[model samples]
Target: MSGFARSVVVGGSGAVGGMFAELLREAGSRTLVVDLVPPRERRDAFLCGDVTAPGPELAAALRDADLVLLAVHEEVALEAVAPVTRLLRRGALLADTLSVRTAMAAELAARAPGVQHVGLNPMFAPAAGMTGRPVAAVVTRDGPGVAALLRLVENGGGRPVRLSAEEHDRTVAATQALTHAAILSFGLALARLGVDAGTLKETAPPPHQVLLALLARVLGGSPEVYGDIQRSNPRAASARRALAEALGSFAEAAGDGPDPAEGLDGVFEELRRFMGPELTASQDHCQELFRTEHRTDHEGEKDR
Candidate 1:
């Protein structure tokens, strides 16, 4: 039998929250969803409550939960933890789906020292589902509840990569924050150049098309979520600064000078050495993606 019989998911109306609610119900755990917005699925018991301004009804419900999972924004989770954790039983597990974990980990340690807790961050978009996707797990307090929840993630085809909260935040700063910044910078540059993206679509090379795709994906998604990713992670600023500095160096290397190509080559060689053996595999993967993108675009055109 699973340790979690009755699970509570805060912010169960959102994509990530709803995904967890569905997964828990499918796993036979009685799930109670609490959110301002009503979730689309009625499989789980729903409660309209605000965790930031939780009432007695919410506190009472938290007391009975075997596992309480927060799938809310980082700030909201931080605001809710103090009130929510106070109501939980000593053995109850508290878990969160936050992109940045260092603050949440600290909050849980301070407010819910006795309660079992973990932080889960799905690396992929919730709409994509969990299959073959990596979910970063930061285990704050180890217990049966934690194990069962991790097992639940694994059973749902999510790969759980255990990481310390600090490590998780730092790694995502480079991986998510820096990457998004670069793509956004590219989009900004295009705007500055007065280049119409639609006009370039047919003529753009694969690399440019890929950047356009990335830019579209980021711009198409919720600005609040992207903003949170950029703002919540403290180390993101450093990553952005590094990117800016690298671009500056590249610009200087490309400038009119004696042996500019030599300077560029030297920089490329250093980068190649830094990437090491992974460079070959990454290039191969990129080529595969380019082919897939090209094929997909053609198929879409044929449909029209």
Candidate 2:
């Protein structure tokens, strides 16, 4: 069959969905945007009808579609998908753009038996488009949809990195979910202290500057988006527990005990671990990303 044979994208008015529609069109896919909100006419075709509280209109729009991508919330994803399952082409690609992947992937596979399904975890901002970005396609063992999905990636200038559904969510739990939580916590701490971040720039170190830049990106990003990333991932709770345990260990190592007057034992313990024989800490890898002796001729361009 031709790629995405009559693929219909649900929810194309919002940021992620809109970006998906734009990129898919650029990639030569004949995509039709479908949603509940009165569909604005797309440069391509669109169908506006509600699927949750199903009606004939929504069911009719889904008929003969070879691919259906749900670019909405986890709570609404499966429900929006269920009503149109039987109407979808026998082997249509059923995928979602939800951050909480494992459960959704499993639930989707169970509901629409024999359907080609996967979970997409995009690692960059929707505004980033697809150029030079890494899109993790968490593939299901049963699906024959990977090829067409990879084609979609290539069309949008992305490198499609294949990962199992489990592996994808595990890595994201740490890399994205936890990382966003820490950055957001840092912002909250700054706000509590009445610290205007701009005041720190003159005396800021490079690491802190990078952090400030990251906070700006996160702050502008979806609150509910990161909320699910941090809260919904199962691994996060265990990770938080481990961090607290490590902190307690540090207190024991220091002479401080539970009292404030004593010195920190945690610092010494970490130093010892880093200097140990089994796994030596290497600065080379660290240096390449954040610090190195380098010179570049490029300077900030002035506004025209």
Candidate 3:
């Protein structure tokens, strides 16, 4: 697809929104950013306005915009759909960078009527760029607009996975919610045991260190964003419950204590079977990762 002539990002001040704005600009689109707060870096291209209310600035931005990207929070994204739909130029493409798609997709379909819209969830952080990354594209209404937006993602080196809003939400519940819950649970366990960061760093094994690093990475992000992922996804609660159940089973197995090895072996075999062909690949990847880490450590020691 040919590049869009003009594009507007509704929440362009945000990380995800800003990243896409930059990507669009790099792709030769005249990109306009609309947000309540001006972007920290690119103040020049931003129009300060509330998208839900549809002010003159937003109307002007949408007047000639060939593409409109909603990169706001889930609730705000849903709210903006109706007003944004009203002002969009005929044949314009509307898309969102929301993590949870089911409710937002439904809201868009109900509120936007004939407007062409798509739901996009970049599986990695914007800072990571799109190279070799998986991006979920939910086609609420398929048209030239949807094709064009997906082409843009492909141009940026993203691997676009097509999914319905319902499918996307269900998959995210397991991939995102369950994983996050596990990490957060680990962090909570550490806190309960009163383990400080310095102590953990000094004493932890490689696997524990890796887990700690993951927990830190998650905690470093916005609480609101993580909260939304945990709270907004309808399947999140059940996923958490499943994790708790697994933990309880582990505890029960440990308490049985008369040769817990056999039980653990059974669990290990089950997981190995579940991983199938990926098990060897995952092990090799982890070994290489450890080698890299050790090399970095040795280099740092020499420098010191």
TM-score of each: 0.91, 0.77, 0.88
lDDT of 2 at 44: 62
Best by TM-score: 1
lDDT of 1 by residue, 165-253 (tens): 89999999998999999999999999999878778898887788888999999999888878888998999999999999999888778
- Computed on alpha carbons, the lDDT of every model, listed in order, comes to 0.87, 0.69, 0.85
Clashing pairs in 1: none
Q: Residue-wise lDDT of candidate 3 within 180-226, one digit each (tens)? A: 99999999999999768898899766677778889999999988878
Off by over 4 Å in 2: 38-41, 141-143, 189-198, 246-304
Shift of residue 57 alpha carbon in model 3, Å? 4.0
Scored against the true structure, residue 96 in model 3 reaches a CA lDDT of: 94
Q: How many steric clashes between backbone atoms does each model show?
A: 0, 1, 0
**Which residue pairs does candidate 3 place in steric collision?**
none
Between candidates 1 and 3, the lDDT winner: 1
Per-residue C-alpha lDDT of model 2 across residues 98-194, encoded as one tens digit per residue = 7667777767667765667777767887776778888888766446565777777777787777787778777777788667767876677778998
Kindly provide the TM-score of model 3 when superposed on the true structure, using C-alpha atoms: 0.88
The segments of candidate 3 whose C-alpha lies over 4 angstroms from its true place after superposition are 194-199, 255-262, 295-304
Ranking by TM-score: 1, 3, 2
